[model samples]
Target: MIPARLAAAALAAAALAVLPAAAARAEVEVDPTRYAALGDSYSSGTGTGDYFDETCLRSNRAYPQLLANGLGAELAFAACSGATTSDLLSKQLGSLDAETDLVTVTIGGNDIGWAEAVTACITPLTDCMDEIEASETLVEEHLPGLLDGAYGAITNRAPNAAVYVLGYPRLFNGERTCGALKQPNVAEQVRMNQAADRLAEVLQGKAEEHGFTYVDVRDAFAGHAICDDVAYLNGLTYPPAESYHPNEMGHLNGYYPALSRAIA
Candidate 1:
């Protein structure tokens, strides 16, 4: 018979040997056969260049494309610029189906008039507070139902898919910088970030209700927000449409990796 000490040693060694295999199995495993990308401008990659077309403005550098490529999954790219939650229910849900194995979304910005608020906040002499306050009202009263409808539609369309709802980053680092274009003051930035936080909270709650994963990018974008030395988000740019949206690197380093970690 084996000695008690020898048996204990053998058991310890066996447990250690089993750990590495378990860790290997635990490594990021997203092998989607068919992926669907849904939601608004962020998902469509409006700020990132190299669009598939003017209609959807689906960029090659979008996180969805990067994720699909990384997983070697066939993608149904339905996200579009200027898309509202209503648009998701009406237009984007067509791309998803039971065959879709994975899905990702970034919506609610347009619904809350995020672009309009940002425009007011950054533009010289504009009373950004009014826009922000109005957005806050929408956030409290209107956004929940809108998000529910949109998320519900997504689940219905992709009943068997693993859905990921990605939230937007807070666009500012609570700093003020006077560059070629006007920047939102520290106060404006703080308020806007607060609004963004509220939006994210709403998005997360809805995503959770639907049994979908909600990936928050606020921490991922902490130092990379506008006014940072190396901003992943675009400051007021020429195209105007790209203003305040995540850049190519933001999608690559921020959104892509955030979603990757969530999937893992």
Candidate 2:
């Protein structure tokens, strides 16, 4: 009964309305071809092996590279040894692409500069705990904001990318079995770990907000804890040449767990 012109117009209107619904219903494209990693020491395998460069910046042993290795994805690890959330955005990450299929980040460790802070307070566990605790106020104020921004930049830069934010591995000697190396107070380890937990939560929240994936490494490093049956770290007692970073075995333990969850 309707005129042909009116019928065409009605069909066009219906199409427009349906278009938005279809777009909303459309599944996100996830290709595991080209990938990139953005973050700091933990992801870069600082104490690990040669996954990338030569400097103290560490090597290709980085976990993100591990992820790439298993996924059969091409990788460009932009993860520096001491990267921050800000680094993820401002020329901070490199070799990225609009068509990148996957992206991962392991940032925020350097924000607290906990390595240096802990190194400075190594001789005084109570003081290190106190100093690290005081910095929480600052971390709470800024780390989330930085993560949110980093998430935005990552998604914006690569609209079709699948992003996965990784968490830091356990650093403290919970069982206090580092041989001659004095272990940190168990209470202090818990305190520092709480901060690390909060950091992972922040990154995970932002990743969820922006529709990216998150990989938590805490549980993965449990038995491999610095003082566990075997050891992951070389103990805080050794010089920079020996300690402060994950050993080769540490990277293997940390990387497989995180990469398994992400790639699977």
Candidate 3:
């Protein structure tokens, strides 16, 4: 009777072990089909050559739309052009909920006055480096705290979601090009791209602290930046506001592939 009892207990233990493995497999098998995209102009597809709304400037060619289509997920696209981190906290969080399974964010540019810096760079007689330095200071002093707040809110609203914080590509190719830029120099371009890199570093640190993914697109845009033969980013557009934003090809080829690979 003792031998028989020992055999039954061992069998029960083995069954329990198998149960956990089975449960893990079940969890892995569940598809992420409810996705929410929240961020600023880069995520909104501004300068992508098409717009859903003039105010928001979202494009069907945007990476978020492409990602949703590829994954067959139901999407709630809440990104908007010119939206800052504060705007995201106030306006975009409404699209997220407990049931959301995936999220992608691309903010912090406007918060650090990226547009203003570019404007300063383009205008003659203004010290572009000074403006750029001030923006960098803002990035160092305030951007991290803002990101923490935004990430905290996102996690609170959608606890189950896998969040991905996407970084910006370097706008210039580190070379002078034919396109007439107001700055018209490689040094300023390099400085601006370095500032962008710094911003990405801060954002990546925040994402890691919060257990979220950070997708870097810098390498992917290597030869396709603003000065490249086939430029992914727009130089100086008709509307000066559109300057320095990614064009349609940038969204399709650069952002889409980088994000798709990350999720896959």
- lDDT of each structure? 0.84, 0.66, 0.84
Every model's TM-score: 0.87, 0.78, 0.86
92 in model 3: Cα distance from truth in Å? 0.6
Candidate 3 stretches with Cα past 4 Å from truth are 1-32, 181-184
lDDT of model number 1: 0.84
As a TM-score, model 1 comes out at 0.87
TM-score for predicted model 3 compared with the true structure = 0.86
Tens-digit lDDT track for model 3 on 108-216?
9999988888888767566689889999999999899999999999999988788899999998876884465446367778899899999989999999999999999
Q: Candidate 3 at residue 261, lDDT?
A: 81
Error of 3 at 33 (Å): 0.4
Give the TM-score comparing model 2 with the true structure, all chains together.
Answer: 0.78
Candidate 2 error regions (>4 Å): 1-32, 124-126, 177-181, 237-242
List model 1 lDDT by residue over 154-201, tens digit each.
778878778899999999998776567556888999999999998888
- 123, model 3: CA deviation in Å? 1.8
- Across 35-136, the per-residue lDDT of candidate 2 in tens digits comes to 787787776777765544754365666566666677656778777766667766775555666767677777776776576556644565335766676556
